[model samples]
Structures are given as structure tokens and as C-alpha cells.
Target: MAAAKGAGTKKPGRARRKNRPSPRERLLASATSLFTTEGIRVIGIDRILREADVAKASLYSLFGSKDALVIAYLEALDQCWRNDWQERVAELADPEEKILAFFSKAIEDEPEKDFRGSHFQNAASEYPRPETDSERGIIAAALTHRQWMHETMTALLTEKNGYPSESLASQLLIFLDGGLAGAKLTHDIAPLLTARDLAKQLLGAPPADYAI
Candidate 1:
């Protein structure tokens, strides 16, 4: 009997598994697409559920509410942005090269069409309440990214170029941020190139012979 039961248990080919998307994954995918195209506030729970082809109970079970889902979506976006930049910046061993790689990555990452400005900036602009966890998380991530850029620039300036001034890094950061803002506002690549030029000038480093 035990042998028979074991044989019956092993009778199937491969065990078939359901390929359906989990409730959370479906909701997140829906929110990501909607939020990327439409502004975050404009998208509501009903629309997300309908678009995801999920029931309200599933969404509520996954995210608790629309606001929570929005926060999760932004967090996911942050991770993706950071990962892309990190990969681009990783190719060059030199810190200066890496610094320039930052701007290069920015220009490269620009959308082909319907490119709106920074998602974090846009989201924060809509939600200014610092008390909210979502707003606070976005603000914190933005600051962290800026700090990473500044620190990377500082390391390059100090280690590669031997610049002694502590303030130089912060100044470079300001210039780079301005360049990025200009690029977004003007929708022109010139500002990014200008920023690269200015970065070389600020670091007292020579222009790179090759494009990043």
C-alpha cells in the first residue's frame, strides 16, 4: 500500500504551477505605468485596480491603500534609477571618469518622448507635507542621491586631482545640479555637455579624450 501510494504520488509529469501574477505585482505594475505617464495624484485606486485586472480586496491586501502603493512605487523607481547610474558609473576605474560618467549617464537616460522632469521632484511638488511618510521618503532619497554625487565628486577631486579645498566639492555639486536642472528645463543636451566642461574646469582636470 505504501509503495502504491508512493507510485501514485510520483505519477504526474512536472507539477503544473499557476502563472498568474500575484496581487501585489499586478497592482505595482499597474501603478508604475500609470504614475510614470500620468501624474501620481491623478491616478486613483479604482483606475489602478481596473487597469491591473485585480479586485479591490487584492489591492487592499497588498498595499493597504492607494497612498501606500504610490509610496512603494516611488521607492521602486528610486532603486531602478540608482541601479542604472551605478552600472554606468562602474565601467571607469578613475574617480574623475566616474564623475563625468554621472553627467553622461544623465544625458543617456533622457527619455525619447514625453520626458517629464524628475519623478521625485514632481511627486514632491504635488505632496509637500513632510509629515507624511511618502513625502518624507522621497525627500530623503533625493538628498541621498545628491550627497552621493557630491561625495563621489569630492573623492575624485581629492584623490585624482589632489584638490585640497573642502568647499570645492560642494561647489561642484551645485554646478552639476544646476546643469541637470537646465537640461530638464531646456530639453537640450547642451547643458549636460556644458556641465561636463564646467566639471573639468572646477576640478582643474583636463578634458577626457574619450566620451564616457
Candidate 2:
């Protein structure tokens, strides 16, 4: 039988369309990609919507507002790090070993997209003042991550390791930020490797040879 006129016709050269991701997944995937690839400050909400292929109404309904959505993204980012690196470091019996392991993970090559530096640090640099944005999501996210780092470092260094937690924690964070920046600029992990060695030295451990 001949195909009827106006019937659906399949062509060999036609491409199949992928099933659309759920609206929430689409939004997260799009926001993360754009924010990481370009920057949070530079990427606008409308652009995010377009990339997500979701309507403004959907985005608002899902997140309450743009700020809320960004906060969600930040939360996701934080949880990812905690699960990926911090949890594993907890397995070490020595608190000092835990501290070194923290920095060691940073230098180790994880299966991930090209290095663009820490997302929290990048957001902080882009939006240092809360006044810069009306909702202040960016500033809040940055502070949240920093507080976590402070708490973790303080616990390991002071409670178990018998070091001055306050000063050392601050110094370690400074080194972390510096190493992240240096790695992004140089496209080499040596800065982070060096930072780990410096951290060991600060803890009174003999500095190990750091490699690229």
C-alpha cells in the first residue's frame, strides 16, 4: 500500500531529537555551565532561561526567584565538594594527615571539566560587596563556603592536631585562594602542589618535593 498524502515520512538523513531533560535539571545544567564558563556576574537570568529552554514562569515557579536559584546552585556546589574530597579525608587516622589530604585532593587531577578555579572563590571575587547585587546571593554563597572551610580547618588543626586553629586556618585559606589563582593563570598545578608543601611546613612537617 502506498503511504497516504500528508502522512509522517521518515527520512534516512533526518536526525533524532533527544528527550528534553526535566525543567529543573535543564535550569541547573544551563546555569552551572554558563556561570562556570563565563561568570555569574556576566551571565544574566534571561540568558540562563534561554539556555535552559524554560520559560520565565517555570523558573520563578521552581525557584521563587533568580537569587533563590543561584543559591540552589551554590548549595549544590558545596555539597559536591564535601562528598568528593572532605568525606574521604575524614578516613585518615591522623588529623595532620587529614589536613594535608585536603590540599592534596586539590592538586590531584580529578575527572572534571577544565580547571576554572573554585566556584565559590570566583563568585566572591566577582561580587565582593552585597550591595553589588540586590538579592546578595553571590556574596552569601561565598561567605557560606568560607565559613565551612574555617570550621573544618579549625576542627582538624585545633582539636586533634594541637595547633593554633584560628591563625593557621586563616593562613591555609589564604594559600588555597592563592594556589587556585596561580593554577588558573599558569595552567599548571604546581602552585597548588607548592601550597600543600607550604602547608606541611607550616604544620612543622618537613616540606616534600612538589611537582607539576
Candidate 3:
């Protein structure tokens, strides 16, 4: 009957519980938390496996190696960060809002999130070797994040104030990168606020008051 048929119709694929994440997701999730909270270099494969509740074989089979895992984490973070910023600012149609939203969220969210600042920056510092593929991947990921900022500023500046994207984008990139670095060093969000306010003025918006 219908009830019997329904009871027999168990969905396929590993029979995971409602709340449980898959092995791959578990590995990535565990690494993300650890790498974000603690720098990536100090953490090892055994710890990541233990935290993820997965086996070493699973880690090897799923991610190949520690370096790959780290690279995956950074690349994922970069894509997600950019997408999240876009979604956060989707409601505000102003190009300037799209531009400033990056700094505003960094100012507001970073502190509440323990304010480690840029994952790319952290990865670059952690993996300094240019020879290895995974290490080079770290550098590439960091550059990709910067490239996104550059292209974003370029488009916004072109649309809003009729300025050349190449020139203004470079300036904006400096403020953003420097602001993040200084904010991390000082444990203060004031530099980001200053950057945002300065950007507002440059973009022809009303100047914001930035007081720490």
C-alpha cells in the first residue's frame, strides 16, 4: 500500500543524519575553523583529522595532502568572501555602496569574528615558499583576492564618477590592503573607517565622520 511503499522508499547516498555534514564537508569545515582561529602552519594533518572526526585515509583520499587542504581552504574563503560581500550589498543599488560595503563589513564584522583580517594575507605569511605548487597556490589565491578588489573598484569607479578604473583602482587597493594590515596590527577598526570615509569623499558621496 502507499504507507508500505513510502516506508521502503528510503533516499539514497550514505544515510547521513539531518544534522550531520559529509566527510568532505566535515574536513573543510574543521580546517576552516582551525585555520581561521589558529594560523595554518602550526596545525598538522593529525589534528585536522581528529577535529573533523574523519580518518587519515579519508583525508588523504579526499584532499590528497595537507598543502592541498590549506589551498582549498584559502580558495574557498576567497570565493565565499567575495560572494558574501556581493550579497550583503545587493540591496543597495548605489555603485558607491557596493564599493564601500567591502570596508564597512570589514569594520563591523571582523571584530565580532575575532578580526584575524584577511585569510589571503595570513596564508601568504604562513606559506612563504614559492617553489612548491601548493605554496604557489597560496600566493595565487591571495593575488586572486586582490584582483577581485581591483576589478570591483575599477567597475564601480567607472560607473559612478567617470574616473579611469586603472588609476583609481590602484589607489583604492592600497587603502584597502593597508587598512586591513594596520587594523590587524592595532586591533582597532579605525583605519578601515578612515579608508571608507576617504573612499566616500573620492566617490563624490557625503564625507563620513570617522572617530575611534
Candidate 4:
């Protein structure tokens, strides 16, 4: 009772792949975590690769260089912050309140410990006076975020809202950045609170106490 030769042979089993993020995603996530916690200029590609558990060749293939990866990380961060801002201001009825919500949300979201301030501002500070394409790209991404906030605030504070000055919106944007920088320096959200109060005064709205 001999079995058939071909029938008795067993087929080789295929390897099962784990459910994990793609190399690009892992690299971005690693870069974002390191860049925000540590300065972008200080964190190198090797660190990012080690954190991401990805290969050097994969990184080079996907991003072309460390600069490209930084740009991708900044772009991703910009989108995330924009989405958070939109969600924060979505439910408010007053355009002015929506603008104010940005400040309030910042206060609420900040943990007061290891706070790193705005990613765009950090990137801008690191890449000031860009000379190369990558440097310019980095700065452009940062400025894009700032420009968006300025435009959004301008629309919110336009003539329909009884405030017609785009300069005021620009001022508010500066205040937000200033407050964030102060918070980073002081390791407290008190500066942001001050910024919010000043913004209220500027908008001629009654000041509400914000406790962090």
C-alpha cells in the first residue's frame, strides 16, 4: 500500500505578515515623535530609523534624504494641527468665539509638562533664512500653517462680524505664536492664558476666566 509520490508530498507554507504600519508611516511617526520632543535639527536620520524600526535603504528609497523626511513630517504635522483646530471650532455659533476657541483649545490641550509649543514655529526657528530647496521646503510648510491661521482668523473677524481689519487677525496670530513661545520658555500655559485675555480685550468681548 504505497502512496502516490506527488500526493504524499506536502506543499511549503507561506510566511504570514504582521499587521503593522507601512515603512513610510512608521518613519513619519518616529520622526514626528522625535522632532516634537527633541529639536528637528538635532535628531538625525539614524535616530529616526532606529525609532521607526525601518532600514536605511527603505528610508532613502521612500524619502530620498533626511531633509525630505523632515519635510514630510512637517507636512503631516500641519495637516494634523489644522484638523484639530477645525474640530475645536466646529461647534461654536459665533465666528468670534470660533477664533477664540483656538486659544482655549490650546490651553486645554497643553499638558504643561514637556510642552514643545507649535511645531511650525519650532521648524521655522530651526530653518530660518533657508538657502537650499529642502530648507525652503521646510520653511514653506511652516509658513503655510501660519498663513492658514491668519486667513481663517481674518475671515472670522471680517466686516460681517463688525470687525473689518485683517491686521487685527494678523495681530492675533502673532499673539498666539508669542504666547506659545513664552509657554515653551516658561514650561507653563500662563503665557497662553495671558494671550487669550488680551485677545478677548482686542475683540471687545467680555473676559472669561480660564484655569489650566
User: Which candidate number has the best lDDT?
Assistant: 4
* Candidates sorted by TM-score, best first: 4, 3, 2, 1
RMSD of each: 6.2, 6.3, 5.5, 6.0
Residue 36, model 2: lDDT of: 76
Sort every candidate by lDDT, greatest first: 4, 3, 2, 1
* Model 3 pairs whose backbones collide: none
Candidate 2 lDDT at 95 equals 76
Q: For residues 37-148, what per-residue lDDT tens digits would candidate 2 score against the true structure? A: 7987688889999999899999999997777787778888888877876677756778778777767777764215456877887876776556735348667876788788
Models 1 onward score TM values of 0.73, 0.78, 0.84, 0.84
lDDT per residue for candidate 4 within 21-59, as digits (tens), equals 889999999998898888898998889999999999999
Q: Give the clashing pairs for model 4.
A: none
Q: What does candidate 4 score in Cα RMSD to the true structure?
A: 6.0
Model 2 quality (TM-score)? 0.78
Q: Write the per-residue lDDT of candidate 3 for residues 107-170, one digit (tens) a residue.
A: 8877875767787888888766678877787788778888988898888767765545566667
Q: What stretches of model 2 exceed 4 Å from their correct place?
A: 1-21, 109-113, 132-134, 205-212
Output the better candidate (2/4) by TM-score. 4
Kindly report the root-mean-square deviation of model 3 from the true structure over all alpha carbons: 5.5
Global lDDT of each model?
0.71, 0.75, 0.81, 0.82
